[model samples]
Target: MVASVPHDRVRRPEATACAAAAILAGFSLACGPAAAQQATSQVQLDEIVVEGAGGKGVAPAYAGGQVATGARLGVLGDTDTGKAPFSVTSYTEQFVRDRQARTASEALALDPSVRATQGTNAPFDSLYIRGFPFNEGTSGEFAFDGVYGVAPSFRVFSDYAERIEVLKGPSAAMTGVAPNGGIGGVVNVVPKRAGGDLTRYTVNYGSNARFGGQLDLARRFGANREWGVRFVTSLNDGRTAVDHQKEQAGVGALALDYQGERFRAWAYGVVQTDRFNAPSRPFFMAAGVPVPKAPDGRRNVTQPWEYSDVDDRGGLLRMEYDLTDRVTVFGSAGGSHTGVERYFASAPTVTSAFGTTSTAPQFYGLGVDRQTYEGGIRAKFETGFIRHAVTLQLSRYVEETSREFAAARGSYVSNLYNPVGVPAIAPLRIGSRPRLSDSTLTGLSAADVLSALDDRILLTVGLRRQTIKAHNYLSNVGTFASAYDKSATTPFAGLVVKPWEHVSFYGNYVEGLSRGDIAPATATNAGEILAPYVAKQIEAGVKLDVNGFGGSLAAFQITRPVGELSPARRFSESGEQRVRGLEFTTFGQVTPQLRLLGGATLLDGELTRAAAAANIGHTPIGVPRVQLNLGAEWDLPWIKGLTLNAAVIHTGKQFVDAANTQSLPDWTRLDLGLRYATDIAGRKTTFRANVVNATDAKYWAGAASFGTFTLGAPRTYLVSMSMDL
Candidate 1:
């Protein structure tokens, strides 16, 4: 069950003079003539003729062209009103296009608090925000076009998006149950749809031997402008710098929209497929031995047969109706199906000096098939003194996983004891290897956003209830088994104050709960199941709109109880973890020709309690302390239709294990882009070139286990051309 808070009824006077002044300031910067004329008139100076200006102009005339837009920073729209509160950061489409970002990870690099790992493995390439790992297995909340889509594995293409939004902290009221909710934040991808023009087409190529294109076409009809259709498609193929690795992908989408006086409808569908080669898992060498490197000084250990493949399909339908002038009703439903298959080599053996070797049997095959369905509805209305918005959502998710492998049933193998001089022996073929697991999540939630105090202050609150059911079909015959059922309620709250038209201050609190399903140690009775895990968060931030310059700053804290896992007992509750951090970002146009955008973040994460004496008070895995991003674009007036841009990313050292026994070093990378746009045969065309890791810096991006590290990519270049018709 869920409840919504009542709206507050109050009124306040508007800021008349302040609004006028702000508008005037904006006009002066946007149009120089008006500002100059006002200045000259005040000075009582004679009318002065200006070049490129009409008679009686006071200021010199200059070519007026489109100004570059900067990134969007500040709070997120889906923030909870009362519980687990936090700030949000957004990057607009204009920023992404100006930077010419090639991937989602690259697009997020504009934020100072976000650290990205660009390893060869697709599953490992992820983002760490405010000391939280937000990636595939441990995904935070994610939304598509402002709608909640609760699937961990969502395939997105940068070419099809208009912008990306990063919401900091827990937001269970807006989002829902997830694997890890305490530490990380949510990222929402906003798609591009019909606007203005009726049709457009673009094609691009990369120097890495990859080519792709997209087509967007729209049509308008009817007297009331009630019908529209949009279509998009893309494809690409390329090889990575890693040894023997290749990647291929294809994507397509279609959308239809209908608009009437009181009713609106939207239908959309998408399909994506990817095939790629997998890289080797990293490992450490013995003490005093030289670290082995590939022919080019990079780590190389990938097996020739390792590979990964994925297929995804999804669709959505949404409808809205304006019941009256101040009342509206809206509903949305969506579904997705995903399939994955992978074959990878595993290095389960390690060497120690104390005459002991540790090893586990290597597995070569794993597969997963997942299906999800989500639906929601909401109504909004405004009264004499209060505005009210309410939302109700229901979701159902299901996932099935299968694993097959051959195991060794003998003593641990040692590097020196290999009589055949091979590091790993061939795995014997077993009669049959089978393992299967299934999980289902059902949830319901209701929320409201209220405007009170004469619209000067806003209040939002919500509650959510969820049930998780799990079953392990192969529990009686393998090392993995689980069966569990549980339920929990999450609450959220937030407050926003608009002291002035250009400034807003907000704070939030939110909570999240996830069911704990334990793995079986033996092929026997049902595995032990523990209570649901809960995470809490709090955050406060401020947003400033200074005419054309926008900026935001926020501070947050998150806490969660730790659950330990082992082969004997599965989970032992013993520790508490907390993450605290601050994030700041600035965007918008600094000048007409030169645009600058950047952000920075500082965070500290620690474990307050642990079973191991040395593990207590240590930093968690993959959390960095300091992250920074800086980007600038210059439009060269001397060279018509030419622009130059540069971006830099810096990340501090990070721990790789929960105990903080091992760590990855700090790293920095630079990227550059050049673009030229002109009219050819009466059509708009653009030529672009990009250089990533321009300095060819060799650095470690991530680590899987003790002493195992993944290297970043070397310098790479991409050249592309696009034409609009």
Candidate 2:
């Protein structure tokens, strides 16, 4: 048994403040001498020679400029890739290293438009992107290392990532399909690779008896520095604060690279396994009534009899060769296989009964197997008159899934007696049903960046043409088959102007398209085909890069028609939506020893049309009206090797149903962290302590269609230690 930290004991405000102040003082002392020396040297520097033409040569070459470049989050791309017509936010390894984010969902919580819903069982994570319900199978799409792959919904881990990028607005021009294209966004996760000398280890312990550790190692070899390798491994296990809940997980990954002056080869493999208990659903009070809690002050809806488990493994290979100084060729192939087995109890509520609730054993199993292969070749050529870049790509993807649902005989009790009275049910056996789908996409695109007007103004124009083929197979619906093939020519144009040294203004227009899949509605129309779905969006924004501060503001709008709803075999032409919003982000040093990073968003999302059967049109459920994040990091002069950090987050109220009859109230939360670092036994070691939800705020994160509400985690504390060699 493990001892638990009492919430009241950890909530002492004076102690928390003292710890934070000590850490900040330590960090200040650690850097005081160095900072003084640098300040003195700055007074003796010589005048730098002017280079290039125009006002660019008049700009000061300050060390602070270097920090501006290094402060970038690499998730946006390989480097400062520049902003697109749409809003894009990049979180770099520096940010991750400082926050100590444990999962992809945790990392994305900083973004206002990205919301995560934790699963009670398994490794499942659901997201609401741009006010639209998105899942792994739907509009919320995820990519790894800039490539598409199937990630297990129930069990997910983000230990081996370098950075995560969130691209707002429609992206059909890049990714071939958008099951949730109407929502307008995509998340790209960049994987860590074997680059630079690296050796790091970390261990963490949290309340509720949780403990875990991770190791990362990388090395380079060969005379020309042509070969490199990186390996990572991690393990975690323990019970959560929730009742009847425990979790255990393990992960491993290896990456290899070979690079020369003209060519590069890379390969990677990852495997992960997790077993965890799920949370119970919660009951909610009716409108105008007071909120309710469980008898034990807990809010679990599922009985203690059910649990969830998952296992995932996948790999990828990529190769690139420079045929010429202005041209390059690349190819990549990867695949993943996932299997899930679950035993749970599902019962209909008294309000609207879909089926009888039972304690009898029920089994639901799903196996998903997918493979993707893509190849592309591109060239960059410039003439004094115009600059152009062209790329042509062809890809094929295939996914097959097998699902089984069955009921067991007799009342089944695993650990405790049934409270609601178990039912003696007849034996029922359902054979496995299979679903297969395949997509072949071919695309050709060209973009030109022109500096036509004395190089003062820049314009980028591009176009893409794509053809998609889709096929579907289901075991229960006899032999129902249909094919959809269409080609779309999308064009994009943008303008960037620099009227002053510290400011840049830009505007852009881009088009997006999403292909729709067809399924048999009835035996008579089994051969009928539906038209492909398409979405379009436009956005504009401005960025300011002054000496001491930087910020960006953007607004966008997206529209798309609904496609066929899967499994239900129903057409949803009325599923039209429009989302428009503005985002503001700022990060920099307010003073020499104080730094701040924060942002806010105000947005509106409305469903212009609902399925004719429902006849409901209103603000989409789950899309909040306002979101905010603010944080500060400060260093003190008295202590050495320490730092203090604090942050506050708030989310506005949001509707919970299609008709906007029910709603979740606004919520606010606070977090604090203290860290100290020093060299011990010839190794660099660091310690960190953090409190999440410091106020023990109680709020509902979301609600399911079944009228069940999900509660957010209460106040919790964590401590961790890390070393570098």
Candidate 3:
């Protein structure tokens, strides 16, 4: 059973303007019939030289070009952070359009160990890296390109990303099992391809009015152009800044490539949709209460006739072939489909401290489907003094989930600093969705790395062996109540050690694989299905890079396993959390017109086992202990192209239950931006203005690892122009 799709017939406005004009007419027929067949070929082309060189494509941008000098370490491809010993960052597509970042958690907000456990007008996109929980609830932890059930399963926009990588800790032997057990970090994405020729356009505005449009195109053909194409699309809609909200979105992406010389290929596709009317939910305190103060950020406890809808479709296919020149063979396959519908109202729970709240509006539905497959072999020989680089992988992933809900006959009472207006309640519709859960993962990995002397020593090792199957059924009838098949192996080791050509010194020890939790329904062994947990990490680092700036300093520790409910209430995995962290990072041009990007992490989490033993040493619920960012940009030796930027984000106090006595406080924010650039009528333009929370701090900004808490964003205001068509 899985029939449900009616949000007023998918919000007809002529079906979103005929689905954005049939996706801009299929992006002009994918580069207008390959440039009208190379302009009536007699074949005499030869001026396509497009080079911004960086091996295996998409990596070049370091040194003030806005991050990226290597990243994409899943199966270890495209790496090079001083020979990788982990802790990577990557970001570019010109830093997601100079930070106009519309998603992927706002392009990871300059990573201070990431955090965004929902909100930025939530409709899905949850995070919190280093201190755990990356995309929670029905998880689909990022990754796309480096594969993982193909992206877009709950929001990931940033128009056809060309970069966005982050790796930080446990990788399950370098990316394999993570269908829902994100061991602290890993983000990936990297799509856009087609270089040289292009067309661009943008137009945006935000804050209280919203409105947007964007399109980008790229092209290339044969006769050595080696075929390529790219397309991106976007559309936005009105009113926002909270209070009875409104938002709409759409996107279409396409990327294709082939730079063959020995076979190489890539293909991608995406389609997205989102709608909200009262979308935003995160707050659930009510037990011993206490944890309120955080109201006016354009407060709106929903009910503008509540609504929400989402749809996503995804695709990917990759290929490689060298077969010699030191062996290469590669493969990829992907799939994704997500669907959701909502009528809202289910996370309000404030209950006092002068805020008082409660909710009940439900009409939810959800569906997810995913698929992934990979194959690999990478070689690069030399055995004498060690040169290696070997790799060997095999992966498979699958998922399916479905749900439906209907509740809302009563229940209400609100006030988060004045939010009243309740009268529409006939919702509760969503018929049939059942199925709920099924997964299958498989793996087999191997790694090598090696390298010695002249390369200044490096080493890495790996192992995977995963395997996990799951099932859950019984939503009303579907049978099969709970099952799990497990296996695990995970392991890895690393070391770098340049020691001077600009410094480098790293270390690692990893392992991760999770999937084991299922008992809920207040557990008496409710649905059982456990067994398959393992997480462990250990890291150390230092990486510099001098002159044009770059930095890193890591320290890590992870340890996982947690599932609770005992005292004979039954449900197990015992419990344990441990996080321990210390990151620090910096990036590119610190002078030369000034440029720099954020960093700072320092976590400490802990709860070394607890089913309640007074919650062991506590400090786990939403673990915060400092996260920070810095960001900067400047470059206006008197306006030639002008520029200026800012950022300051911070977070600290957390804990919101699990006996830590309810908490959440420390906050800080600030952001600002500006841009200029010349030529207008003759094209080549650019204009921009930004101001996110530019001092409109209302606090409570994060926390969600189940303790719920998000709500912070209200100083909005954005503007954009962009040209070059």
Candidate 4:
């Protein structure tokens, strides 16, 4: 049973001993970032039929298949993307159905270090990667198959993903401590499994009158076929391009599997609901206005019966076994619950910029419940020439939240480039609902990865000890104003060198831990709570893969600690916020009919200390020293299956305050796409179309590192069709 007869017997990796995983990360355990049950409890079914055989665990696709040569580095189970030293990028599901992207930040906009800070009809899916800010409803920061209460604290809909990696820097010791820490990195999402024979259907459309449909099913039989099943569903309804915004969504996902020889299992389920009508607002300045002039991205000052609604459900189950062939044991658990209702119309305070504005009217009801768990143990050893793979993990996440909001006293003055709307005021309620917050995140990690010379020199080290508890209650005197518990220990290191097998060179050093920062109403000791901060990073990179393309270039630095205002103005936490950078990217096939993906970034952010010292060396507000992305795809060589694409996005200036005298300019956008495939009568078809912001530029889509401001995302149009049913 357990690894039936040594599970195809094989062993040749040995270098062992990582000091019992750095002394068991100092004890208190639970936390496994992207731990696929710690590599399926150490795999082994002849190492999954030797490398890849139906029990598929991600990775495959590189070279024009829309990215993915390697990903899932939390515990390094899918290594090789030039032997990795960090800086991942996955994205594939045929690149989100040929870039018809409906979420996951528009398929990560082909990452020039990611951006998507809640613009584009805004059903909310915030992001900013690499230069900070990550707000999926305030820091839950996505992740799903790789854990994190099954992603959906605010947005998660890319047809339930099938890959979306994006790792970058500061991985609390390689995926273990991120219960809202997000030291500027992390985004995993890999759901949708169940292989072979499948039936599908899809229909979609967009542009001011949305429409959608989707359903997919997959199957497999037993007796060696190993049993599997998959199901998916989706629906959307629409109206958007701002002005009167409207949206509706629904999703259902299910997956089941079993592959045995030494046992393998899987389970996943999800249900989602969504709604929005008129919601899309963020652009407040005031304090000394002057950052105006960004009005017409189909202007909509949100006031036609504002709305938002959401509901969610979840499930997960996982298993593994292989207590031989060099050990293996795995486990996983999951939970999820969410509900939110919002009535809005905030952000619109200008003060003066000739476009005068003002608005204040909000209401909200929120509820959240989350639970997660993970477990692991892995081993594979060798010594003489070095070779090892060891891991020990534990994880936990808990959450409970409840909220009620109010803010409808009176105020509505318009003119942010001529905008007016009134008649809606009813919010002065604030509190009386009870349970406001709660959180718990635990972790324990230990790792090792080595391979000497012949394997091309690779090394890795790990440690994690996270723990962060939080509380805040007082929704109406239920008491508990605050409570916090903290702990930290994050550490990691990595190195890789391949001299040339296609080129590779890497480096890493990481640390990250967060929780501690609550002082925002422009601070003045605003809500207090500070003392759980740690962030550090250092990176170096180079990668390339010749023939079929694929490239990378990196340089990094990160630092953290903040809480602003306090040259006596109190608010403390001693501030700090470095973040140097230099990144470059590239992707598959530069020939075979062209294909490419973007990259470019170069920042040097700052803010060393605050509270007036003239904002320390400035440059913090909303970070943007340059960002770019470029995409291309072509394959019209007499149209065998057709394909055409284009993408280009840019961001450069940003700063909306922090005393940086206001800024916010510099933007660009352009996107276009097409897809085609055929088979018709025998069924096996595909067709797609897209056009995003194609010259509908009215600028201003940057600055949301917390101080509002968004626009730029107007001209959009999409279409889709699929079949195999």
Candidate 5:
């Protein structure tokens, strides 16, 4: 029997000094703002291996140890990439530290199929995967530990993450409906767990005097080592690469678990806060204006007094029991809350070729609360010549949002190139935020994998019935404005055929779900709720693995529905957007001391149907035609435990408007790094250094599907050291 345990307990960290002091008390590390800015400093500890109902502990790394051999696939549990029909990749904790990634977006930049749509200094993070928006709407699309609503809402730090997994294409049948209706892919974060007795300390420094420190501790108790606990805390504060911008962040996380012969349980909690002065914002293009050249990457037009602050809290509990050798049951409950307060100019609109811009400053406050519950059963058995693996999952997700806003006294004008900063405006008073919207999603899914012929052939089938219910209320008064409830069923079918020991052919047909649209007041069917829209994808691929080298080539097509108004002024889901793409990825050790990781994606997107005839056949906004990334690492034969690496990222031109009248030019960036591993005073230690945008190219990084664009980050340096005790 499994033992009962209380859920996670999380608290907001105090100021930088207090929080650093508290976390550094028992450790032998230094504290304070300047501690990390020194010439030497030490980083995060590795997690202990503990398997839940998922069948195994963390997946093993490939030859180079930068990427994992497999990743979690929602209700399907942990799956090897070579055996799974879908395309997925998981970056290991080693990769995160080697790159010195401060956030999820930084670590994800290496993927050719994904692109960041916001600036590095933006208040929140947003991404586009496979030519579609992932986290662009009111609700986030990230999942923590195979469940939604348990990770930070706005941004995710890598301090407490064991691995970051990306599953390509729509996954409604595999993972359930995404809160934001994202059809591109799913990004999952695996939290760190206790592993081995360890105490580790890390310190880092970034360009412009940014300093940070982290502490990690883990211990296992009991005679059988069934009880484990791990805790991690970190803080970063100082000026940033951008002009007039200062950022501060603090994070604390705790994880506990109990591993028994037949029962297992895990609990996780995390709290984080981020503060920014003169945070960067996206840019918009005025209608009929020609796109202008990008300004210097360090340019900033916001007043120094403008600021933003965000706080996030999350907790999760999971338990599993094995009824028999062939059967297991599992359940999990988790929740997260995000709070935001900011006073700054919204997206600035460029009005002329000379870079003249206009924006209105405002004060905004927002709150989002999310909760998720899931339970599932897995069974494995054989009948005759076929071996079957079956699973059934039931899940529910709920989200609530509230907001308050007030505009400044007047608008401000600035030049993107010259960056004229105006005097700080008086603060706009905002009242208590009222209920804005609430949504509930419920789903039941089942899948079965049938294998025969010594596991050479595998066929999988699955289905999910998903229900979406949402309510919108007027701000302040909290009076109901509108409501909708709808349900739909999505299906999945996949096949994998292995002809040789190291080669496989795979294909899949899957469907995705999105909330239906509400007719506008001008439509004939005003206020009517349409049926939930369904997206379909057909994919086929080939995989190869031999002698520590591996790669995959895949081709797929996705078609999504869009709302449109007919000639009769009746609104309905009658339009469509279609995208066809090809992907090629390679990862592993090419030689004894050389490693390669990168790929390229080719996309062709078109608006198949539209409300306006003039828009037919136009390319979708923000869908680049070509994207490429190539990275390599070489271990110096002359020096032991030393490696050098370099990478290049390039994106093709993209349209900024649905009408195709505005566009942003293509851009390319280069990155370089080096690291050394050695023992310091009998303790294992590593030192790393990196240069981002090494050429200091000034360009437009990317465009949002909504027609906004982000400025590229300037050249910057990063360095860090980690030591284990």
Candidate 6:
């Protein structure tokens, strides 16, 4: 067996501090040394002026740019949200940078329809969208540049992102088949690109001594400035607001691209490493134990010896060629390799309502490698007086995963309100390797859109054939436990009508796909493979745009089968879960000095059918009934370069179990921010500060889809300063 680190001997914290300091010092040298060298140059330098503007994939900064007017649509290319038949929101890079966001969860917290189940400091990133959970250690919910299996499998950060786009509903026709089958929608990230020649540096600090720095450099060369290159790197180290929290992370990315007359192509390479010590995990109360009040959000019960570490590497390439003025062909291929090791007391079995608990944490590790690719062709033509556009695409993905597991010596006793650590616990040695799972997904899709009446009306119809295969093994010492292969077809239709120039009415019927549930070992048909599942959705909405100040109101209903453990102890798909909700959203400027961004969702979710008759009409686990958010950014006329921002997010009470017997109270969170733009010496500079959970409210944030609960984050502060050379 492996020996364990003592409870009092945590990982070296000074090593992380030194690395972070070195990163910041390097950035300082890059900013000052180059200019000093230029001033002292003995030889004249010939700076060749490249002619023509280079291709820039990132959306340009617009007037009062808090949100993007449109987003890149898979196969169909970039689409204007006003003319699209779906509810879509794309947050710009400016919003992310000015808000001083570090992770995807913090950046998306303002969306009314979303709630971070694990709060912001947990090891895993989990969320609920439209009253459903898209969570797991490996969520597979994130898409990079409209492609899956490329982003980090465990979690995603915003260090190298240019923008984030969320398509609000089922999108089998728009994105083909997702690996996780996220019926609610897809969160896609656009990587930064090289454009104008420039170099930027930033220094950041947050609560609990968090400190870091970043370097961003871009350049273009070649005839017509057809070639471009960009590089970005960052490192940060600190303890979080939580007690004894230790965290450190480093990330680097390189982007290269070429924009020719008829051909455009780009590629990206990224690597990241993250580690945590004494990190907090969620609790799972026993069925008979009375639920206890949530403990202080800033307290930590984790053992100092327990930790989680992750290392990830990924690369991607995309190309597009114009076959003709009205037709184009495009293709993209990407892959990622991720390794994770976690040993923590994540399962908290409550022993009493007075805060006593029993814990038995284990060591779990996994490595996964994936390959994904897609290609498509799109063309536009005319049929009589109607204009038509057609697209055909194909995609495939494969992943191989292996894992190892070991248990600690004995259980440790602790309290939820006050904690104690037990010594003499030993760690296990890595004895063997096990082949865990291998999965594959392949799909083909075709779509057509027709427009008429001076482009006032549009109708789109699409279909996709999807196939999925999964293999599960009982470790390397045993035979395969199950092999599942399934196929299905999903179809969708949409209509958009513009009775006036600034008003549009739209409706759609779409479907999502997923691997079906199989019978458990207790069943007679144990190990049986089932067919794929298809979720259906119907939605309608109205959109308004008046000089860039606009919003949308939509109503939608979605239904899908859920897995269940029958009274007989057998597992099957016996419940039909449905969610019906109305969404209200607004964005853009109310005036030149004032901007607004926020929305609200009202949902009614229930189990329409179930083997347990008593649960048939019960509310589904973790589905919040209501959510609201409203934020404003105001440019101070009295202060030429200053802006003030604030937002509020509220989530209604939610059940934690299918029986609806256990529930968490509603929570309200507040955030405030400020920014000032000015010239420092001769370089452009910006100073920003933000505070989340300003009140330090102690509350359970919410529950994940699987009935696990996460405490809301504590009061946190973030500040940063950036300069350009």
| Candidate lDDT (C-alpha), each | 0.58, 0.58, 0.81, 0.77, 0.86, 0.79
**Total backbone collisions for each predicted model:** 14, 19, 0, 14, 8, 0
Tell me the tens digit of each residue's lDDT in model 1 across 28-125.
Answer: 22324444445434444233211110001011111121111221111123332111124655565545555556556667767776665435335334
Off by over 4 Å in 5: 1-56, 521-524, 564-570
Candidate 2 lDDT tens digits, 1-725 = 11111111222333333322323233232333444454344343233222111011011212212122311111112323233334566565445556666666666766766666443322566566665544534212466666665443344456766556676665556555543233456666666665433578899876678799989886555543356777889998896555556678898977788877888887878787777664343333344333332122133334454555667787889788999998888888887777766555443121212212224446656666667677777676667766555565665555555666665545532211112423333445466555544555556655555654444466766666766666655443324355567777766677767676666577767666666545346533454555656677777788776667667787777676664343355554447777777878776677766777668888787777666445345766666788888877776667876878888888787665565766778878788888787788867788888877777777766543334445666666778898876
Best by lDDT: 5
Question: Predicted candidate 1: what Cα RMSD to the true structure?
Answer: 11.4
Worst 10 residues of 4 by lDDT: 1-10
Whole-structure CA lDDT of model 1: 0.58
Best by TM-score: 5
TM-score of each: 0.78, 0.79, 0.34, 0.32, 0.92, 0.91
Task: Write candidate 3's Cα lDDT for 561-633 as tens digits.
Answer: 9888988889898898998998998988978899888889989889899887988888887888989999899
lDDT of each residue in 1-725, candidate 4, tens digit only:
11111111123222011111111222112334323243334433232222211136767678787877877877555676788788888888778888888778888986998787678676677777888877644555687877788778777888868788888777867776676677788888888776544567899888878898998776655534566777889898878767778888999988888977788989988898989887777778877767867877878777777788888888889898999988888889998888887777647677887877777767777878899988898888888889888989888888887777765667778775677878877666665566888888888888888888887888888888888888887764557777788777888888988887888899998887788877655666777778778889999988888889978899998988876666556677787889799999998888998888888989889998766777888888778998999999998988798988989888999897777888988888898888888878866688899889788888888777667878788888898888876
Which consecutive 10 residues in model 5 have the weakest lDDT in total?
1-10
State residue 318's C-alpha deviation in candidate 3, in Å. 14
From the highest lDDT down, the ranking of the candidates is 5, 3, 6, 4, 2, 1
- TM-score of model 3 vs. true structure: 0.34
lDDT pick, better of 1 and 4: 4
Where does model 4 exceed 4 Å of error?
A: 1-72, 78-116, 123-156, 162-183, 195-213, 227-235, 240-242, 246-379, 382-576, 579-606, 609-613, 617-619, 622-655, 658-708, 711-725
Q: Which runs in model 6 stand beyond 4 Å of their true positions?
A: 1-55, 59-63, 476-478
Q: C-alpha displacement of 544 in model 6, angstroms?
A: 1.2
Question: How much does candidate 1 score in TM-score?
Answer: 0.78
